[model samples]
Target chain A: AKAKDFTYSNRGMTLEEDLNETNKFYLQSEIAVIHKKPTPVQIVNVDYPKRSAAVIKEAYFKQASTTDYNGVYKGKYIDFEAKETRFKTSFPLNNFHKHQIEHIKQVLNQNGIAFVILRFSSIEEVYFLEGKHLLSLWYRMEEGGRKSITISEVQEYGHRILLGFRPRIDYIKIVDKLYNLS
Target chain B: AKAKDFTYSNRGMTLEEDLNETNKFYLQSEIAVIHKKPTPVQIVNVDYPKRSAAVIKEAYFKQASTTDYNGVYKGKYIDFEAKETRFKTSFPLNNFHKHQIEHIKQVLNQNGIAFVILRFSSIEEVYFLEGKHLLSLWYRMEEGGRKSITISEVQEYGHRILLGFRPRIDYIKIVDKLYNLS
Candidate 1:
């Protein structure tokens, strides 16, 4: 079983990388315009060597308040955070931060489409859960509810994103269905 | 004249800082969700100190391929790049790159609002020039046209953004005009 796990791990690309590749394909095909926000870094010090490029001598990673990816889809604003977990039974609520939950609410208030791409990597499956659905679970957790959502609950609430060759994950196809786009 | 120039320079702020402050105000008011993309940096090395935070020891800033700020407003996608120039008579065409023009075209094709925020720093004036208008000039430049657009031309083709106290530059009001939203 461990050897089989190793094989799966070796063959499987990270969900982020897959999404990046998918976005690139979408961009080239003129379907959508999406991009992953760069990791915020705090630069403290820099060294300018004579006749050479300046080097960042000291820096630290800064916490981002928003989601990882966002862009335009069929003239609508789309925003989301991508997360992957190995646990097969359920997805732990701790994976999401407090600020992110609030951000999703704000996006919804502005009438924007916001969601999370949840990947059960061990099972090689992914699901797209809308912001409203995530908020319900988030509020439940806040009120001493279940620590995690069961796999069946995810299946019931989230739309499955089937893997593909070029896009790697065809989540937009599901978006079209959700938005009633032809 | 020199004294007057000093007075203008002393009172005027950089367009970018002004825009950041404006965006912050917009966010606080729940008007729109837009943010300038972080300057991409190529992290070369990092030092993880024991019992302390990791520090980036070496890194270099990377050139950005796309426009600066993007987000959603009124359920529609919005994207734009901002540039300020000291030149009073004309905005140099070289201020925009080839890829950025192409990117703007792509955004427009997808039915998203795309534009350039042109700031004449010396005059303390700003204008919003839409992507289609920008393309016209870009194509003209390609055909060995004038290297820049005169201030008169900008005033004729773009919407002037007046300075304000709350949001600093009221570009959104101009956007309202462009989208025919009161």
Candidate 2:
């Protein structure tokens, strides 16, 4: 089922690059308008070069952002964070931050679509877990539950996102099913 | 009526800062999830110290972003650009790039709320103009029309945003009226 043409171009691309490429395809096709927020940086010093663009001489990477991607899909607000975990047995819940968890909860309260795209890099498979379900496990962990969620647990709770030629991840198909979107 | 408390607090803050502060207030109150996208920078060089955080040694400012702010409001995706013009007569259309205009158009096509918050910095008044109205003026300009929109025209086509204490701009009230939200 793996086509040579599809395999060749996406061979060495990182997960972030792959998602960005897919997002570009989606935008060009008028399917969606998701965009990854730029990494925040605390700029300290800058030099204004004469008759040219300003050069930043000193800066530091700022704190972690709220989420990676967000946009409108079918008149509904879509927000998600993507993560790739190496462990095949379980996914470490520590990958998400406390503030990010709060952000997802807020999105749900606003009646928007909120979820996370978790990629098992070893297995080369991705899963979509709803914010509500993730929140439940997160609270359990705070209450002294296991620090990681087993692969089987994810298999039962999350939707498997099949890879495709065009948009690659095709997460929207899962979104349609999850949100009952027309 | 310039209140002493409001003046003292917001004295040195720029229009952008005021908006950001208002956004923070909105987010904290769970009223909306709007955020100003960080200024994008192009990294050139980095210094990685063994035990400390990596420092950006060289970088340059990137191109202007699509819009200044975006997020979910009342289950509807909201996208907008904020601009403050010192001109009392009209807003120079040059303030907007071709791509920004196209972005607002895309937001409209997606059934999301798309608008611009224009501040007449001199008079300390702001107006909310719909993307559709902007497009009409943009197209007219492309066809060799006026390079700027008159204040009278804006008063007719745009909604005046009242100032407030906590949220500052209070643009959401205008949003409710514009969208006819219950």
Candidate 3:
């Protein structure tokens, strides 16, 4: 799957870039409106030079209390988190935090669309798993079950997102299918 | 109004701190799940001094493309932008960006609750005005009308929020009235 037919430079681009491109495509095509929340950073010190832009002298990543991406799509609120892992066997549960899980649950209780986007960075594969499925697995994990979700399980329950030229993550098609959108 | 019985605080806490405290109160008091979106900064240079923290050496403020706060409350999706003004007569239209207006319009079209929280810092008064009203005013401003929303108009359609110890904004009470939640 990795070496079959790939010619694009996955070069200096981070996962954020891919997701952003995907969102841009979705917006232009009028498919969905989604965006990655700005990375939460705590700035402690800054230096403002006379003729230069302000430079951050010190900063730290602040723990996000909610998921990364959220927006409205076709009369429904959409929210989700995106994670990339190098491991092949499973995606680590530690990638998610307790508060984020609680937030997603609350969103679900309010009849909003909540999910997680898992990226297998090694193989360049992405899967979108609904929040309910992830929650059930997470609960089982808490009860001394699997600590991580296996790739096979993800494949069974999640939709495989094909990387495209525009809107890199075109997951709205899957969303439309799951939500029965016309 | 300046010489009223109201007290003043010059603690000079950052905007984020004020919002965090307000959100903490909101959460504990079951008011509304309102939060400031993390500040958007474009990192041009970064230094990995140690494994613990990555220091950003150079950064610039990126124009925000969406409204700051959004969440579900009482079965309705709530989206809003918080603005603080010192002017007594009117709140400037420049406080809201074009994209933010478009985003609010999208939320309204989806049947979600969209509004603005305007804070007159000098008077310590806050008002919650529906996005539709803001958009109407904004359109008029574009057509050579007043470049700001007058305090009188705001007083008419907006709910005055009396900041308290718990749930500082206390806008959820207004939400309950708007949505007939209870």
- Could you estimate the TM-score for every candidate? 0.93, 0.95, 0.85
**Between candidates 1 and 2, which one is better according to lDDT?**
1
Candidate 2: pairs in clash: none
The weakest ten consecutive residues by lDDT in model 2 chain B span B1-10
Among the numbered candidates, top TM-score falls to 2
The residue-by-residue lDDT of candidate 1 on B40-102, one tens digit each, is 899988888999999898899877778989887887888999998899999998999898898
Please provide, for model 2 over A1-182, each residue's C-alpha lDDT reduced to its tens digit, 9 standing for 90 to 100. 55334442367656787788888887888888788888889999999989998989999998755788888888789889998899998999999998889889888887888999998887777789988989998999999999987899899999887666778777887888877885
The local lDDT score (0 to 100) that residue A110 gets in candidate 1 is 79
* Interface C-alpha RMSD after superposing true interface residues, each candidate, one decimal: 0.9, 0.9, 2.5
**TM-score: which is higher, 2 or 3?**
2
Off by over 4 Å in 1: A1-10, B1-12
The DockQ scores of all candidates, in the order shown, are 0.73, 0.79, 0.44
Measured over all alpha carbons after superposition, the RMSD of each candidate to the real structure, in angstroms, is 3.9, 2.2, 3.9
Top lDDT model: 1
Off by over 4 Å in 3: A1-15, A49-53, B1-19, B29-32
Q: Residue by residue across B18-122, what tens digits does model 2's lDDT show?
A: 788888998889888888888889999999999999999999988754787888888889889998888988999999989899988888888889899998887
> Of 1 and 2, which scores higher on DockQ?
2
| Per-residue lDDT of candidate 3, residues B91-141 (tens digit) | 999999999998887777767788998988776677899999999999999
